[model samples]
Target: MIIRTRAGALATTAVLAVTGGLLTATPAAAASVCSSPKWRVQFYANTTLSGTPKATFCESALNQNYGLGDPPGVTLPKDNFSARWTLTRDFGSGGPFTFTAESQDGVRVYVDGVRKIDAWRNVTATQRRTLNLSLPAGSHTIRVDFAAWTGAANVKFTYAPRTASTVDKVRPLAPTGPSVSYDRTVNRATLLWLRNKEMDIAGYRVYRRPATSTAWSRVSGTGLVTSDTYANLPPATGETYLYEVRAVDKAGNESTGSADRSVVSVDRTRPASPTGLTGADARGGVTLRWTAVPDAARYTVFRQKRPVNGEIQPVVEAATVTSPTWTDTTAPERADYTYSVSAVDAAGNASVRSADLTVTRGDHPPAPPTGVTTADSRYGVHLQWSGSTSDDVAGYRLYRDGELAVDRIDRAVDDTTRPYTFAYEDRNARYGTTYEYVVAAVDRSGNETRAAAVTHTTPGDRVPPAVVTGLTATPREDGVLLEWEPNQEPDLKRYDVYKATWLGDGPIGSEDGAWAIGQIAWLNETDTSYLHKATPEGETVLYAVVATDDWGNSRAPHTGQEFAWVTVTELGTPTEG
Candidate 1:
């Protein structure tokens, strides 16, 4: 529970005129007027608060101390006097609250005219009284009364709402008198409303919606507005929009929305520019097409002629159309021109022009190439196609995997049987890889027609790598160290070392079967040397090396002078023992 002191002095004073060392003949009339949301108070000459008040002024709170002296701006005696403070304020969706009062003499508290706390007894020290109560929603009046019979005199009273969400489930009242004003120069709408009366109000939420829409959007963002005013920038489309505000309490409960306010926004927004504009020469004329723009009612096309030399002609309006496509039958034949487009809305606002497109009038693209075929070979991928039937066809272009691979090819077979036949081999293509090829035909005017496309996967490599050469073996105290030249094949996988024991021989024969051959070591493609540590001393050993490819193809192992043979020596001997 939180307790707040509603403490302040009198807000207004009633002047009692005194003339010529004597008081005025007319007594000052009692006037009770306090600023909004402040307490109204009255002071009496008697402790019973009977008869007319000696002074009636406004106070912000009931806290006061007049120790052996009269109250300020009042004629009440120092002792045997009384004062009362009262106010009627909205509690909104009220919940639990704590009321407290402290006094040196006597004090009492009342809510809506019903007594809630009473400490009506004279005391030498200040006496305190507190009580908890559940308040209902809406406006209620609170009153505090204090009397001093003798000695020091002081009194204080305060009340606060319990804002715990679990204990306070009441929602605040809706904001009142919501109004809006629009500034056409800045395209902004300012909204103002009366603040909620709830003491526990957290903040306000402002919402907006188009006049034609039933859905509302929260324009205040994720956070609540702590002020009574808000500014929003609605679309300046000359449309009418509505706005409303709601009050939120500390418990997170929101009230009903306030009355809707309307504003007419200025029309300053323009339609979006056209996009994806394309122009092509056709039999009738030059045709232009573009993507439609949202909220656009029509479109305008602009054109300019391209000269062979010097600066291009000035751009001029070509046509106005409602649809996204238009044809210019006025364009002359065999001429080059550039075109652009812009979109217009119903409000007569025109957007920026679209990107320019160049087209040659009466110059049509050649027909696409046909009879496209692909074949896999050991060399690479093979592509074959027939030329376009169009007489204006100048050359051909090839695209591999959507990228231009061959820029131009002018040569074609001159044979009468297949006069337009063409073939191309892609030597850079790798084996066991897939490729997509496209064949296009170009016209004299540089217009290319996308043509036949073919997909092919090359066969896997089956050839073995070259035999290992320059192999050398040196007998050491630990073992025989063997080395060889590395193979250059791209698909080489690894190398294998073979060793055989020569029982009795000057030179080992290729077909010798008495000596068993065993692979002593398998090294990766990058390794070019190996050390055989398991060789027996005093025995002649033949070492052979072979290269293998990724496809499991290996060179045949050979035993000759190329394959070194050395006799193992003792630990300290340089020659065979």
Candidate 2:
């Protein structure tokens, strides 16, 4: 319980008063107020006395006690008690006494028969007064009023000297904030708190004990500081600690102990290594499974990317519940990968990592597509392929302008997409401009192979078949002239020209493909030229060719040179188409 007084001071315990008294008490010794009653007083030379009174009283001297008495029955006055003292205790020097009569009971202290302490009641209640005698420091007669009673009679009293020892005062501060907390890294408990408002503080003392124990002893203190921190405390290993702090002020005053707190510190040691790690299929990715260690809080999985030559640095993708299984969701296909696992305790301490488990699966890359690459638009492009993704391919790929344009499975499927296409819509591309293009193939194993291409660009985002090279058509007197520069391709295979009355500038692959006028087959890899004859005069002629590599790479149809325009002496102006 807390005790509070009207003075606003509070404490845990209250001071009790002694009750009852003993009879027939003997007066053992007597003493004086000043040093041996050598009434230290001062007297002025020419101060005359007033009021006519008998000289038997000690007066007109330095009077110390002038009033100590009961009130008259005539009036109910306030508590007015004083001792007139013109006396000074100057460790050594003495001087004159200028005095007056101020008393309580009938006057008993007087000088020259003049009463100083006035009291009309009998049995004085400890009346005291002093006067100046102008005497030396040796000794002097100072009288006291002995009336002890004011109303009902009791025992009389007198004045005596009592030695008083100085009082002790205290001002101490208490520690604040969370006194204790767990240290996750070291698996230990750390205690921290602050001290403030310590006035005249000499030092602080800390005392602590186990919750189950009652004995508390001093632990430590830095004498003075606003705060303190302690860590790595295995004090009593697994038990809780209760602490209190006391402050000692400079004047030997001690403040009572502050509030106490019981703190529990955990031991949080790490768990055992995980076991039985196995891999299984989780959808398209591999699922890694492991046994959870007892007392383990979480598990972490790592992925190791197989390097070209050096050792691989394992990477931890995530940590999860100790169920100990993780789906390798980011697994890469057709490549070697390694893995490892570890167990983490509640304190975040991790166990030694498990042994490395590795697997080598696949190493194949996609086969190169046998196709002709050409730029066909400001961003439009074309590719013609003649190969499959496998000797037994699930699909074949055709790319235009270096982007995948076709993915078809089966040779029969390849035959249907004879012409592959791509159209770029980049805002930064220009119309009627030149660009380069290439094509690569991706296999069933997610592997990509390099390009098989022909370099040819069009007047407007189109590339002609280079294997066809050049061509011309003219109507002569005897017949029509049809000529073509054989494909410069070292693997030139064949050529074919189509003839009809064409409507647009599009090449042979476009709509309205006309009839074939002639076809030529190449016999040598060094063949750089070819020519064909037209079946009729004034006919529109379009030609295209194919170049086949040892690996079956091919080219697409493209516009040959425009040579069908008529030139004649009869017509001075040449007819242009």
Candidate 3:
């Protein structure tokens, strides 16, 4: 008989029993002939079920009908026969279950020998009964009894689990008989396990972990697997990995893991090649660097001397290090070499070599310019220095006040000779300002030497203003009006005016002579015109103007012949001055 529980239907065997007493069995009855667990059935000739069973065998289900006829494998009075079915099996984490039965005449159900369903009355139509009960975890037994008294004969009994998540709180039993197989050609592992007996089982989950690690990782996909087998690709690093399976139920509850199955994988993959290789000539050695490779246990650096005149050199191992940088202190000076790097894993698999990098050793900066000197003049500051003695010197660089004033100055042809001299004029320098100058020598390789520096202050302005031009004297009644073009000197202090008397035949007063008026008026730099008032009437007056600077350096005054002379008439009208 297939008895339905909340989890699923379970096939059971029958044990003959009297209506009011337990039936005895021989020792051979303990051994069942069924391939799989099934319902063991027996038929009795009497309705009270009081004698040896006429037939004994196993059937997958209890549903049967015999209308006015006898059941198969038995000869009985079609209307007064009895049958029974029973089974004992594990109910892993059992929970609430419902038992249902329908039969003609009478039928009853029991759990662990306790009567749970009773409908023991003969009926013309099929009688039905259902009972709900809680089944604890572990082994349990179920029994069903049916009797046919008259007319049609039939019986059906089944039970199932209450699969509702809120109703069934028990978890499914753990999957068992787990086994794993590995394929070295593909680096993959396949796991298999016996399915759990729980009919409400949703699926199974497969888990894996390194044999040395305590943590486990789900190898199956995110969704629960609905099959008893799984396939996954484990890392092929020559390490042992453990695999297990777990059962999940429709209620979303999961059981404990099954026994662990382990497999050792073969390693054939190599680490990735290192990249971004570069090299530089350092003070202590030839330093090389490259990008780090994942899963690399160490890096190997290889180098070979550059071909000279088409002659190739054999490559040699430089160094093996765990970091991304290495220094070869034994590298010879003044040589060119090509370098490459490779990564190696713990399994001794080496990756392909990285792209090669070319480097030159013994590259040093040229010597700095020496004998630096500075001199200030009225125009600007002047800088002079001796060229560097180094033959590889490409040019010199100049800096003013810590800023680059000149990018480069080509080396002169005479720079190779003794007493090398170079000069640069900084016209941008201002008067009375202090400045710091630095000079360095650069080589073709872009290496620069220590700068030679000097600090100096520019001299103050001592230059005088230029002579004034466009001097004119207009004869006005009040005085001789004078105006002249303004001087453009930034340091001009003022203008000085002088007056002299002119006779009818010759000039009487001169700028440097005793007959001249020494000075008449002093005007500020912005005042270019001056009015000399109250001059002698009907007389010729001589005028002169000169420019002076802030340092008291004045322009030479006009001589007698150059003075502006103007004659006045009795009406006070000036002729010319």
Candidate 4:
């Protein structure tokens, strides 16, 4: 509840004096004066009633009587005397009111800056005249003028509400503090205003007009007697509307309209969901289709990648189209992708997602293997080559001597390094056998690339190479450096160094299959030294070496030559000096 101080009115009265001589007359007897609120009264000694007055004071009422006589300190003429009264007061509530002016000569009256009565003339006897009025609840000013041109000089005035009769002559007060509110979901607008306090208030009338038009149309019913609030008024979405209100009394009198307020209605309802969503795989793309939705301004496309590792989840908006069909030209072949569509209304409301459609791109072959090479042994051959770098490459296919030896070689076969390459050991060949090896990469779509072929010939039977000896490990600034005596075999192809966490149970060290041949390539078998950099810290390291002859026979366990080892205890990550 809000309270406000009622503004008070400023009351002021002025009396002007004129150059008129006083009139002589015998003292006259007094008559009864009307009873009413006090009024500022002044008497002038001339008919024109101009200039300073002979008598001025606050009169208890407008009624007064003097008969051809003079009062004790007064010297005003009785025949041509004039009088005026002014009153300023608050009416509290606006309603129909009446005013009566009785005078022996002529009289005039004014209310709230408006002249309501005028009968200024000469007359023989006191004649009474009445005025019907409707006054709004606020401060008002009333003024009366009278002239006594004859014997007995007298005047009186009175007023009251004319609500029960046909005296109403004024309109009700205008309502204040008008406001408007709209609900987007319901498309309804409500109007409210300050209540009218007029005693004879019958009801209020509500009106509205488009913001762009000046013609107002009534919104409320005939007589809204109980509520100052009008609700459930339909307003077009996206359009501006203005509202105003006016007060009316039981006598059908109406005040001016209140100030107009405006609001723009919004559309918040979502469009219907897209239906019949379908998709098909096209050349290098995916084509999607769906049924058109009523009132849908556009359609939005969303995509979700395959649920495999690293895929974006829940999908996201991809594109907006006015039509019901869309093509995803950027979809990659042989990859899993799912699509969905949604309809959007003019107000930016999007419908729920349509059913999902999954697609796998068309087939595309893997790239060819590069750098193919082979090493021959007394029995079979060994192959090493670079693997395919394509994301869809599933494995390799190996062909030997113009025949397929491995149809599907899983990429995991070479798990020794990141981005593993292809390596194989062919142990099915007889001595002196000539062979041609070819390798090709296959994709997940079953497409294979052109093979890269290499030729090799197995060596004739010969004695195995001598064992490598005198192996030693010495600590260096970078890491442990290993040294060993060269093998006695004149056809030694290379030397391979092996390391492990020396469990110390067998000639090859502890046998948990922790054996791995270091990647270092020793082209010269006579070069019997190797440096191991950045070895794992806080562990005993074991080192061993095997000598390989041109026939691919390693002089260790392969040829019954027990491997000799050198051990370094507590090796730390090497540091630069």
Best by TM-score: 1
Provide the clash count, candidate 1: 0
Q: Is candidate 2 or candidate 4 better by TM-score?
A: 4
Clashes of each: 0, 55, 19, 8
Error of 4 at 10 (Å): 18
Error of 4 at 198 (Å): 13
Task: State every prediction's TM-score relative to the real structure.
Answer: 0.55, 0.24, 0.52, 0.35
Model 4 local distance difference test score? 0.72
Q: Each candidate: what lDDT?
A: 0.79, 0.44, 0.77, 0.72
Superior by lDDT: candidate 1 or candidate 4 = 1
lDDT (10s digit) by residue, model 3, range 1-577: 3222222211233333343342322213543443344677777877877787765666677788766666653446647889888777777778788899999879989899999989998898988898888898877888888888888888988878888888888888889899999999998899989888776788998999999999999888789999889999999888899998989888888898999999998876689999999887864467898899888999999999998889999999988999999987666657898899999988788999999998887866765778888997556988888876555567888889888899898745455665377888899987668999998888777778745679989865655577677888777667668888898988888988877654344444544434345687889999889887775376655676777777676654543223333333322545797
Task: Let me know the TM-score candidate 4 reaches against the reference structure.
Answer: 0.35
**What would the per-residue lDDT of candidate 1 be over residues 1-577, giving only the tens digit for each residue?**
1121222232234565453442212223434556555887777777997876666766666677776666666545557888888888888777888898989798989999999999998889889998988899888999888898988888888888878888777778889999999998999999999988888888999999999999999999999999999999998898999999999988788888899999998877788999999987774477788999988889989999996678768899999999999988767657799999999988788999999899987766766788889987557988888877656678999999999999887687643653388888888787778898999988788989977678888776766677688888877767878888888998888988888765444445444335666888889999989988853455566787788788777754542323333333423435647
Is candidate 1 or 2 superior in TM-score? 1
Q: By lDDT, who's the top model here? A: 1
- Give model 3 RMSD, 1 decimal: 17.8
Residue 67 lDDT in candidate 4? 52
Candidate order by decreasing lDDT:
1, 3, 4, 2
What is the lDDT for 423 in model 3?
82
lDDT of 1: 0.79
